[model samples]
Target: MNWDSDELRAAALKLLLLATLRETKVAAPLLAELEELGMVAPGTRKGEFRLLAQQEDKFRRYLSVRWPEFAETEQAFSARPTLISAIALRALRRAPLKLPAGITQLNRKTWSAWAGAHSKSGCATPPPGILLTSDENLRLRPNAGLQIIGEQGGTLDADVCRALFGELIVPERGFSRNWHVTGVLPWLVLTVENIGAYIDITIPPWLLLVHAPGRNTLLATRFIDRLPATVPWVHFGDLDPAGLDIALSMRGPQTGRTPVPWIPHIAFELLETHSLPLSSPWPTQHLPQKLLEHPVLAWLIAHQRWLEHESIVVLSGLVEDVTKLAEMLRER
Candidate 1:
């Protein structure tokens, strides 16, 4: 198999975990860490470590240089895979994890896929529309067919919006009227608490639909730039780290116009009820450098807490909270 760097690294982690299982004096802390990371699969933790009785000198050398701390733990576990040594480590570590009955190849394939899915420890790719808001209209003129007005005061239809306009045009929603370069933006741009909430479209009238799953915040930002700076972009999402990070990403460099949190009290309430763990052993470090500097984001990261927008949907407070948000923004 032509393993890429990412695949090789994934394979190496599996080897490291399996090798650690072989140690006679398995440390309690290490096991706890593994559990916290959700790395151990059910039924697999019960098996005895029968892979390799004797540690290879080359493997030991690799471990010493790669993860010296883990190597010094007095346990015979394999080293954590570095970005470069993953390929070699996988080759060396696999032999020791072979199952009996000569099913090593089958076991290796299964373990590799499972580990690759679960072992990705970086910040997740933020989902579309999760935290961005724009003043894009979702109202469609079914009779309007494809003709959309262009910036040059000419009309371009569905073909142009779909092909050339790209992120400049709203997804799924067609132009009800001709598009123009200059127009007055509404005072509030509201991103739906749930991207799939079709019921949210015209409730408040001023709430603009931001269909981010079909696109993303970066694209939405392009459209939002045309709006007046006084317009406050509001976001409602889960109260988790990812949700806050999404909001941070959507806000971008418009430091003056922070996206208003819609009914954050509801998220906090749900968080209190669920009592969910705020951070993980592998917390996301994916916020952009600019966003990382924001005080709110910095505090969230420091405290390791977030609230999800989904919690509001479950409590049936979406409409009421959104109504409150519109009223609040008007007051601001």
Candidate 2:
């Protein structure tokens, strides 16, 4: 089942098209393949085939196992066969540049048109070249992998911006590809993984706070890339494997000069009291090598405990601890 192969995918799609039809002629070799796969049985006449009435569930189950995306398409087709068929036919005729729009251009329909007309949350499986949003709106994937969200302020170079305007929030429009912090560099750059913790944590005049948001690190890494190599970097996130990996991902390639986990001694001390039990088994296989060797991470793994950044932020003396962390990094 090398589903990644283009030839295989095309063959699978052809089989799926046959399955969708109530009564349709199929190529003999294709029918033989279907019969072998338990989807169809040979008919009385030669070169003829028919799907068994009792094998409908089996056929669907087989599709679900072999091609889950096709299974989703099959479900979507049942709801709106005409729309689905039209989209499929349009895709087959010519690949669409965007999504439903490229296929539905003549009708002057938007991608959200499908949602409004058919009550579908989204296209279950987009055609080969098209991309769709959750609400079935056609959208091209952004070149920027992840958008950076954070707050900035303090005495910046006059050229950077006209006025500080107190603590300036990063504009919702996000930074451009060439965007970088220009002016007096912050004493420390702190990347936070969770929005709640990022907002709750106190930001000092000498600190630049960035929202990394889980495993998506493109914008965060780009922001860090623009910073002076001498600027100390640190990450504050969950105490789980994902948090450790995020910190590792943001690390500088220059060996010793990289972002370090901002877990202070207080965090380790509070772990036993504040930490939550692992809801699911820890995925050890995916852990970064550095995390696997980390004494704190190892202890957490052994004890099956994880701490959330929000929990640590809510603790007393957290502000002091962060201040102390900045001071220590400054001294380093």
Candidate 3:
């Protein structure tokens, strides 16, 4: 059965719970945290319930009575995969988990795919309208085809945010042979390297999409020259510590625009909160040097690390705080 299918949901949930248990003990406190983050939720706690255990009878009893062929946890994890409950951590840190017989390869590739496919962490599936279409290349398009459901300052949720990273969305007007530059970007540009290197069937090292290497200066001087005084140019790339650092670096003297949050905070908060099985662990140090000088970012630099999309999701709240950060820095 497919990982996302109803038939596999119970197995996935059991696996996630079991995996988390390897590290921590599953109990009420952990269950409370999971509920807050929308991990695994059940009715009022009565007596000592078998949360997660190897006892076959105990495990079966809890499922048979409380959850019938579980299918709801996936939806919970899908929207908020980073909401790591104690149960999850407990399961993961426990005994080594084996992916059933013949399902051997627990390689990075498998883990990455599983995280993307399962609601246990990250998005359940890629967002709609964001496609690997056109010369069959990955493209980041506008918010043309996505359905905005959330009422936050941003409507695009984590899934939508992930989907639209570097993939093109809206096609074009007049049906002209075209490439789309979504949003009123300040000065973001795309360049092709090793272009035309793949003529025959050999795949080239050239990726369909990547962050513009240099900061606003080189990026502006070279590919995109003109820009309005006040513009929001989001630099989207892979969701990693390096990606967050790069976004953080593209600020200050670069664009001259007071760094508003153009990235998403929801992504990182969920990633950390859920303690999702990482393809790569979130970096302890990822903020740019200049940002590291700021007290708020410096604090994040000190011990906490924000993941991708956090800046964008939390931008509105951050603008007012920038002044506070400056004040604190000045005192220092």
Candidate 4:
């Protein structure tokens, strides 16, 4: 295994953390390099290595000399990497960051530079518990707000309402900030997954349509949380494992409401008439237990077939019957 890997380093750090208190035993294979360095001796039992208390200081010194990153203090052990910690500390000092135009306009590389981390994925996925706002803890300031197709009718805050220009509005601000909706509310909220299907579907007057992009349900969840707990929500997405998980993740914790999976009646019809062969094996292990036992998923797995939401929108001519579909969901 790579000696400098996080897993190896974390194992080494654990040994250092505990060796001072008593003889610490770890799997023999995990510390082969430490054994080679004469820092760990074979334990009393088979397939284990013992780090003696006397060797703890020598081990820490060796790591500090060779790999300083692994020589972290006890407090820093539970914390993020040094670079990430520094960035989070700075961000906490300037909590509730002002981004009038939202995080999308902020440069990724600039964010990385601020974090002192590798410039690729650092900005995209920050440590989840770090950057805390006055009201909520956020990983990254939302780069995009939930795209919506419906009228707020003075329900939305004045500042947010001013940002609306047309039938579809993607707010330029983060949802975790001051954005909120009050007063009158939609009878039902339908979260659509794909952008193509999101734009294509005709929304009924009583229904509020919000785009729930795959795995990025942050904004959508925040928007739903602002609504009353009784406001019913449903989800429509591709008939697949990932889509089902996305729908599951859309459950609003604040409202204590789990959105009903809106597998339109036409979806099953299209699955039978125009279903496509699975291009790749469905990673069912990634699915939650609820989805694993789902009848539709079981049928899809048995048939090795999957259907896209766009197909249901196109082949089923759902745009015309969307109002009736809304009524069906409300009736349920």
Strongest candidate by lDDT: 4
Report how far off residue 30 is in candidate 2 (Å).
18
lDDT of 1 by residue, 139-209 (tens): 22111123445655775454334344321245422222335323334446655445544233333334454
lDDT string, candidate 2, 1-332, tens digits:
45433335444444454443332332444455667977786666654566766677776666577654666456545554445443453343343344434451212133435422233434344345444422211111111112322354333242222133322344323433235455456777788888788767655556777777786655565556767777778888888867876776665433334577777556676777877788776778866575577666677788888888887777677767778888887887
Our model 4 lands, by Cα RMSD against the true structure, at 10.5
Model 3 TM-score (2 dp): 0.23
| Candidate 2 vs candidate 3, lDDT winner | 2
Task: Give lDDT tens digits, candidate 3, residues 245-302.
Answer: 5555553343444222223233333443532233544464545455345443333444
- TM-scores for every predicted model: 0.38, 0.51, 0.23, 0.51
Clashing pairs in 4: none
lDDT values, one for every candidate: 0.44, 0.58, 0.35, 0.59
Clashing pairs in 1: 129-212, 237-309, 238-307, 238-308, 238-309, 239-306, 239-307, 239-308, 240-306, 240-307
lDDT of 1 at 126: 25
Candidate 2 residue runs with Cα over 4 Å from true position: 1-88, 92-174, 251-258, 279-299
